[model samples]
Target: MAAIASSGVKPITGMLRRGLILDLSIALGLGFTFGSAFWYGYHMPRTNARDNFYKKLEEQRAAKAGN
Candidate 1:
């Protein structure tokens, strides 16, 4: 009984499959969109780069003083 069940579940010949090229193309497009968003956020001058740096520096100074 077990052998018969295992044989039924085995992969049949010519049943192998490969990813469609179209699916890969769609994934590449989504990656490009997310990458662009990250690039824009990191490099945009209007973003709070200076404020964030000063905030982190203050934290470090406070930590050093506490220790």
Candidate 2:
């Protein structure tokens, strides 16, 4: 009985095989979006240029204090 049941069981296939292309396309788009967002937020000049901004501000403050 067990052998007959095992023989009757077919391989699992074809449930979600239709939309593979669409799935891959969405994955690629989201991957690029998240990657660029990470790069901009952490590695872009605006984020790293904050030190320069503070230095300029301190310079202006010192000039005003000296005046």
Candidate 3:
């Protein structure tokens, strides 16, 4: 009886450890995905050749305000 209890406990402990590792992997993956998206968005090239619609609107507003 004591041997059976100890044997059952090993599998449960191993499964719990694997679950924690899987959780860490998933969290890191999500964090990296979000972090890369933010880096890409923040690092986009700034050029007048590109038609930035919202930027144009803000510029027009500023021009109007100055006038």
lDDT score of residue 22 within candidate 2: 78
Residues 1-67 of candidate 2: C-alpha lDDT, one tens digit per residue: 7787689678657746757777988999999999998898777877669888998999999999995
The number of the candidate with the highest TM-score is 3
TM-score of 3: 0.47
Candidate achieving the largest lDDT: 2
CA lDDT, candidate 2, residue 12: 59
Compare candidates 2 and 3 on lDDT and give the better one: 2
Query: Please, what is the TM-score per model?
Result: 0.36, 0.41, 0.47
Worst 10 residues of 3 by lDDT: 42-51
What are the clash counts of all predictions, listed in order? 0, 0, 0
lDDT of 1: 0.77
Model 2 bad stretches (over 4 Å)? 1-18, 45-47, 50-67
The residue ranges of model 1 lying beyond 4 angstroms of the native Cα positions read 1-19, 43-48, 51-67
